[model samples]
Target chain A: MTGPLQQVLGKAAEFGGTALAKLQHTHVPGVGQASTTEPREVAAARWRAVTVFRDDLAGPFPELEALGPDLEVRMQPAPGDRGTELSARFHGTPTDEQVGELRAALRRTKQLAEVGEVLRVDPQPHGTRKATLQGAALEGAAARAPKEGVL
Target chain B: MKAAIWAGVNEVAVEEVDEPQLLNDHDVILKISKTVTCGSDLHLIGGYIPAMRAGDVLGHEFTGTVVERGKAVTKVQVGDRVVVPSFIACGHCWYCSQELYSLCDNGNPNPGITEGLWGQSPGGCFGYSHAMGGFAGSHAEYMRVPYADVGCFVVPDAVSDTRALFASDSVTTGWTGAHLGGTKPGDVVAVWGAGAVGQMAARAAILLGAEQVVVIDRLPERLAQVRQHIGAEAVDYSTTDVVAELRERTGGRGPDVCIEAVGMEAHSTGIQGAFDQVKQQLRLQTDRPSAVREAIRACRKGGSVFVLGVFAGPVDKFPLGAAMNKGLTVRGAQQHGQRYVPEILAHMESGALTTEHLATHTMPLSQAAEGYRIFKEKEDGCVRTVFEPGG
Candidate 1:
């Protein structure tokens, strides 16, 4: 019985020591450091098309009460050499399908850039989205685009 | 032993009382050498604070010589000259460890809640109301101080009691305001009220390198002192539209920081005007906003407002929308006297902060009641009245 009890106490001490070490490692000194690769780089690689939508439809799309009845919606897409940029404004919400259609239109307009995926989507409260499209063959396609209204 | 007692609102008397004895290992018996009445004492005398009884002691700010110490007391020895912080604190509690000594968990006389001040209720206070800890005040010949090691400060032999007295409350309170407001070099700071605390706030602002300091008050004498002694511009709220005047002086932007030194007793005629304006436009009633309203409105966008005043009950109809829209931050706490007294004493030693101008009246302990009366009536240009108990 004494041998078994001694083993249990030894295990408890080891567990406590390990837990304290992990806590000290994670919480002390270097807790706030960030990795080197910028968030924009990852965003550019994931999105092939840009989509602009109203603020209310930025979350899950296509619900009856999402957009109020009185809102007026407008979509404006500007053509760019590398990819097309889309901007939208509305008094209320918009459907997800409407946002998807805008992305398709942008992809077709920028045929020189092979649209790989939707790399970024930013929803502004005043109804705007700035998205970056990625291409498999083209390196630094995002950096080459002109900076203008993309959302 | 003789003690200063309050007979009724605005009435005070001195009478013989029982001498204090140490009840715990942490207690010490102090023979008070000096004591002074605080403005908060008026709250009790005027019945604004409930639970005050006849023959209760009336002083909170004091300094004394310790005649005896409990067995557990280690920091201070007998015959030590100590300046006692107004609030008692236990050094071991989380609040005390963080230097928020006023909120010490183990310090308050009432164990379960925040009420103990010195003598009155579990929120005991020395010589104030029963709602505060009911500990007898230092106005007496002898008094008991609990947790003596934690709350008492040894006065440097070079410092006079008159100059070091304010380290108990007002000076530290002013420093707390400036510290919390984040006053920095080139910031424009405005302090509302010209009381001793307000004057100290202006001084702290100057010390912190505020480019301009504006002090607002209606008293001509106080305003003059603010200008001559505190070296801050004075605004007489009685004659001047304070908000408009401040904005005009600050190049169309309000003060970068505003300190509300007046607290809950702030009275203003602008409440009716604000209410009328809101009623005509938004159909809102704002007739009851305090002077803090003006301070909030006069603060620049993204500025800070430090409230150093004592207030009771819920604040009514504050401008939440304006604070949010302008990104203004409001912060307030009771003065942590224990934490700031040492620094204030150093400033005093260096001749950097002069409190002599604030001591407009001084008298012996025999005339203590009259001192209270003079200060209460604001007679003889009294800003602060100090009583030399041993004199």
Candidate 2:
């Protein structure tokens, strides 16, 4: 293997790893196919998975069919993780308008299947819980830092 | 909506903050009827827990009426009177599946911060410092309860709100401490700190078949409560030699189990207390482990040691030597109230527990700042202050 060819192979492997890590590679071929008018690079970027939800519940698959056929949600088991794995695919590339809707829908469906629903927060639930200024000193100084069963 | 806001260190006020909204499908909107101040909240308002943002709503132990529910909430319905546990559990995480509610893996939305703080993140808690999952506390007219189907338990009409409120945290935590302490028939238990949690721990030990229970505290009022209501021998540790007295009462052997119900910020009557004061003042240690250190020192060799009190960071002189030499089995946790909620309700219904008397002060939610002042100063022998959000 020459240096140039070997470098190209290495780059390809790195790109594959990144794609798998992102879970962006389309499992369903022709599902997110580009139209004749669309640019290939733009279409690929839009088709990449922006969010993924995985869980294992001992019941029927979430009837997210209301999510529509073009917008597909798949559930399957991944090794070493509990419950099912769920991911969504948008037919063609997802527009900015479609992405937020898909993320919200996927989050809702996953919460429903896994824990029954998105655990809501009051006055806004999701935020940083850290205190304002206490950690600064210990951090500057290089500061360091449950049972089962019913009775 | 009005709620008790932690405006700054040593400053608590009832202010108008936006009432909680339903941010998830499993969420429920509760019109809080009864919310109580917890001892742990002191750590928050004292600025010891760190990362407490101004305007953080504060109150975790509460009972309420569910006024609204998200589409997915099925276990509880709108208009149901319920008591929500302090620590939020997703009910399906690895920790929740194991019935360890406080350690629920998926419950804390801000895992990155907690992971940075504690090496690994635990579950979120209401109105507790943001270091835990920073869910808003319940000292408000309306509370947003996440995973209502899992965390909210219905209160039976037979059990009054006053009696059932402790089921959310104090009662369950004491129960957990006793249960984890391996309290059983013929076992002698020693509990440090006669606060609400301490009294409950003493009672739980007795209920679990402990032959004798001894509670140590400096407050006479709390000691009396422990002696009379909890039916335990109370030690005025400030004057008496607690370690010596326990050994004498236990036939020259220390207590079979020791429960440290007083979390951080324990008052001590000895030189160690002074040391802790200096250390805490110098920012050398995050917790004053007077009760916990005493619990370890006083437990019988080979006895189980359980810390029901929560401590955030490093402590000086934890008595690791005593633990290793004596072969002590130590267990501690934030209360997994979810696991014990049903049992506690049954206990309340059966008259095995009485918490109504603990609610010594009931005030309108608007007086929250005053309520915290009385609680912090132990004014009028106040053991607990119950705030009525709808009062």
Candidate 3:
């Protein structure tokens, strides 16, 4: 049975995977090897994901509300576009819970991308593929969350 | 030679004041080479400081040559160029031995006051009031220096008279202000006032690694000097709203440290001005709370506000509640010359701190009255006026 912290991490990793896939298509410039042919759809999805994520994190998060207005979080292309980036600027006081969640999400996102490579099997059924992706995302998230009863 | 005698309120004359003769076993009689009129002297002349009389020789900060010394005086011999610390502290006293000479219990000549720290009758000062031990001041051609071995420091050969003269008081005071204020690397510091001490404080702040320094003052030339030469952001409090401007510049948090270098008699227009003047007249207000108010308002929460300026009377309406709410710390005292003078001299020797720029006027001691008038009026960019008493 997964705990609440695990559950949050799992959801965050799934978001990371979807965001990473879209990021690869819009950003990865090299031809053939692993490129998205449908540029318009990829761009639209990237925009939608970024907008949604930004809005979700923009409002007063009870954990980070005290860190003041200097708190800034944004998504950017990782230095070698193969990875995604999440940057946060903290100025004032912030709770331990807020800091922990932010760190966990960032770490889990990177782990999900690493595990996605192993599950890239060819011609799998769409339902099976979705399940595999969900399993990999859950495993990544679980690994990043702190142990139960520990910070 | 006659000395200018301070008889009463607005009454001073070049009268035949007694020439100082060595009284103590460790005393040295100095032929005053240069004696700069200080802002505090104005308070004495205006009859603000009680116990001042007709014959009180009046200058505290000066450099001179030791013309004569008692048999016990060994460290500084006759004819040596020396700069006297404002206070006469016995070298062997517990406080002087600890380098906290300003609080020396044995050094102060007055028996009524418990040390010279505060609220006590003034300790003995050169040319200050009778309450301050009635010691003759440096304003005359020749004056006596007690505790010559401890109170006088040898001026290094490398430092010029024009630059090194302020080492006696203003420069050391400024250094002490910034040092005690906890000025550190990458600190956003705002210094109030662009007078000699204020400029020195800004310079010290920069040397101590304040990443951003802001100097606030009314005079344009002083402000310009602070901006261009001292490398600080100059704010004209005359025109700009200082509290709001500082907040905006410091990301709505305000400076990490604010220094009230303006001292007791900062004349600003409006409600603050009325309060300051009233406080001065009342004698209940010693610390300039207006400057303190501005410093408190302009400091980031948990920052420090340093009061280097002199306050004569009691302080009314201190914002202790606001200071507590903000978790801010405030600390100030008279300069500890013994602690910092050697280091300041070292810096001067190394060419790191040059005070020549602050000395805007240099005249013979005969023109001392005019120099005082100009300094009081703060006219024509007169930041520091050095008087050559020998001339």
**Winner by DockQ:** 2
Residue A91's lDDT within candidate 1 is 33
Residue by residue across B1-391, what tens digits does model 2's lDDT show? 7878887779887777776787888889999889999899999999888656666788899999999998878889888999988888888765677788888755765443454444456788888865565678889888898888899999988999999899998999999899878899999999998889999989889888999999999999999898789999999988999999999999988999999988889899768989999999998888888888888888999998998887887788889999999999999988889998898899899998888878989999999989989999999999999999878
Alpha-carbon runs more than 4 Å astray in model 1: A1-151, B111-125, B270-289
The pairs that clash in candidate 3 are B57-B127, B58-B127, B127-B137, B284-B314, B285-B313, B285-B314, B285-B315, B286-B313, B286-B314, B286-B315
Instruction: Report lDDT per candidate.
Output: 0.63, 0.75, 0.64
What does candidate 3's lDDT look like per residue over A1-151, in tens digits?
Answer: 2977666656766663343233223332221122435544332222111111121123333333344465665665544332334455444444434444443333233222322111111111011112233334433322322210011
Weakest ten-residue segment in model 3 chain B by summed lDDT: B113-122
Per-residue lDDT of model 3, residues B193-311, tens digit only: 88878887888898889998899999998998887667888998889999999999988988888888876666676887797788777755544557777888778999999988766
Evaluated on CA atoms against the true complex, candidate 1 attains a DockQ of 0.01
Query: On lDDT, who's better, 2 or 3?
Result: 2
- On lDDT, who's better, 1 or 2? 2
Question: Looking at every candidate separately, what fraction of the true A–B Cα contacts under 8 Å does it contain?
Answer: 0.00, 0.13, 0.00
Provide the interface RMSD of candidate 1 in angstroms, 1 decimal place.
33.2
TM-score of chain A of 1: 0.20
- Comparing candidate 1 with candidate 2, which one achieves the higher DockQ? 2
Best candidate, TM-score: 2
Ranking by lDDT: 2, 3, 1
TM-score (2 decimals) of chain A in model 2: 0.40
Ranking by DockQ: 2, 1, 3
Model 1: how far residue B78 lies from native, Å: 1.9
Q: On a 0 to 100 scale, what is the lDDT of residue A63 in model 1?
A: 26
